[model samples]
Target: MKKLVLSSLIGLCGLSLSAQNVLIGEGSLLRGRGYCEPSISINPRNPDNIVAGAVLDAVFYSTDGGESWIADTMVSSFGVWGDPVLITDTAGHHYYLHLSDPTGENWSSEEILDRIVIQKSTDGGQSWSNGTFTGMAHPKDQDKHWAIVDTSTNAIYITWTQFDDYGSENPEDESNILFSKSLDGGETWSEAIQVNTIPGNCLDNDSTTEGAVPAVGPDGTIYVSWGNRGNLYFSKSTDAGESWTEDKVIAQQPGGWDIDVPGVQRANGMPVTICDRKGRLYVNWVDDREGNYDVWVMHSDDGGENWTDPIRVNDDTGSADQFFTWMCVDPVTNILYAVFYDRRGLEGNHTHVYQARSTDQGESWTNIRITEESFRTNPLVFFGDYNHISAYGGRVRPIWTRIQGLKMGVWTSLWEESRYEGEKD
Candidate 1:
């Protein structure tokens, strides 16, 4: 097991904010030697069994609640590129999804990124199957994919951005959100369908329609949201993936999803949608509407038809930047928790991890710092797109990438509600 890195003592008069931080590994063979943009999952079937994935074919598995991890690389006949997303179904099976470099000649030819590959493991990510793929539109790049498993039906649903000409500035090039599903434990998948009514440019910037993450509601409704051209849109399918509503604007992102931060290469205000046990939908994203980038959240009580105004999740005044936010609602408690990189109480480019909890939907929030020490990022280095979090049964794990000097690594803050007492010890 890795040694305990740091412990953050957030003393609240009436709330407990005790958290322990751990470094999964750095320069480990399991993490493909070097990596970023990590994704993590806590198995619903077994909370002790946790799995994490990172960019460029790196995977880490821990059977003891992330106390220590064994690093390993992922294999697939389709060829693994990057943009790793880890998810789990109700049957105790874990799935790793990523972009593909099938022919191993992505730079030489356009046929390299031929599809999106999914590899499954039934033994807690010990080993993986060959892999199954979807969205195989040649000459098009499939990137930034996120998946959610419907526990009721054991069906997996995914949404992502498909670029006509990746990074092309040509006005003829296009980018759109795509959706697909797998019903047979990843053996096969439904045909990819376009969900966005208006397509964006293919520059993979603010105009690009990207970050389409899907969430399953209590009644089996699949809800998805993304950003483009300064507007955040939402769409849902009551009849599974067979149909979807035209994109509807739920809120204005003001400066659009793509924004420039001081120390990062690229950053965006991509929306993360999550449904609580009561069927209420919650979305979290970053925006500078308040004169600075801050974590904002909005919720819908009556499904995806309507949403409230954006509520600031960070408690600080608008002076520093808060970006790369991810949210999760505990199914057992229905409490909303958000995690993101915060520069509110720091100097220079130093950033810390912070969490906000809302007991009354999006009406009110309590922000707490989770990182004991601060870390800075370099604009010259690619810092990935987002962070990830998973919470169940009062066990919260927030996973993120941290780059100190020349070394970059992934970390998680172990948050257990049981350890929180009204008074600090």
Candidate 2:
């Protein structure tokens, strides 16, 4: 009877009295472990078919969404030193995984062009083509992030970060953002164009990296957000990577200097943007509004013309903990889900994964602790299908990675609805 009562509470949380918050299939991804970022993508043609990135020699796949997964038995190497980015573009009738794997060790392995790879999967990632994306250059700096937007005309918009024009790391030096375009669907890239041309340093220094997350909204509105200092910097490409406007200072949270915690990591960082059902632009990021490194949000109904003030999502205040975040919107219902890593119960101050939702665009938020178990790194989240709700209502899945010194691997948690039954539908 005690077991039955505990099971009832757990089922009331997310399980159907049978499933748990997240399930380990083919066992957790064993290869791409510690301090690594993993990504997931579903065949645009088939929502039931999905693929996730983990350590090489081992990645995982699921044919029935997140219900069951079959591990790739073949041994391969995916440059697992950095967080992985993923996308799927249908060529003719086949699906390809645009993946980034450092080509060789040394700096080349982390190059924006060389390390980035795209593998074709005609049989749902069971096999891949040897052809890779070339022509882009990976700067000497390892502090980088990138995004690829496939335009209707087969064009691709690529964006990444580099040291400011001077290319110096001196404290007196400045850093800026750079972007390139590919007119032939990731085949050839145009000359690099600097996006954050504003005077002073648009690039801000962090513990060890400098970069941004780029997202393209409706009508080719290219946007990128990052942390420099304690505030957040936003830039947009009105002319689609050709000409960029000045750096827009979206939000800034003052770094905490408390008695116990001197000079803490700011709350405002790692921003993400997406277009909603009515084309409204919504932006979100990890913030310390709650005193801890919780999540805060802001929105623009006029398509980025203006934005509402910041709203705090996670109630965790002042603890200074949260990482590994990604967000998506459901066009059919206009609901938004943002999944990220938190350090509520980790060893020391590590990261665990949680998710928050905004049912009414970006007005209010209700955060859910998705993973009963969280990781020490950022949790990668993506929707399997935009047309339908996620298996966990608006919450998707977290292909979460765990790190222990030099060893690492990945696990996943389905961000399903547990607050109310059937309310998500």
Q: All candidates: CA RMSD in angstroms?
A: 3.5, 7.8
Q: Estimate each model's TM-score.
A: 0.93, 0.72
Evaluate model 2: give its lDDT: 0.50
lDDT of 1 by residue, 34-116 (tens): 46788999888898888888877788888888777778888787988888999988888999999898777757867766789
Worst 10 residues of 1 by lDDT: 3-12
lDDT score for residue 243 of model 2: 84
Error of 1 at 91 (Å): 1.0
Question: What residue runs in model 1 are displaced by over 4 Å at the alpha carbon?
Answer: 1-17, 28-33, 421-425
**Local accuracy of candidate 2 as per-residue lDDT tens digits, 95-172:** 222334455453344343233333445677566555344323444332344554443444555555544332454655
Q: What clash pairs does model 1 have?
A: 30-71, 30-72
Winning model by TM-score? 1
Off by over 4 Å in 2: 1-35, 55-58, 72-81, 90-103, 107-115, 148-155, 163-168, 171-174, 199-204, 207-211, 256-268, 316-320, 343-352, 373-395, 403-408, 415-425
Please name the candidate that would achieve the greatest lDDT relative to the true structure: 1
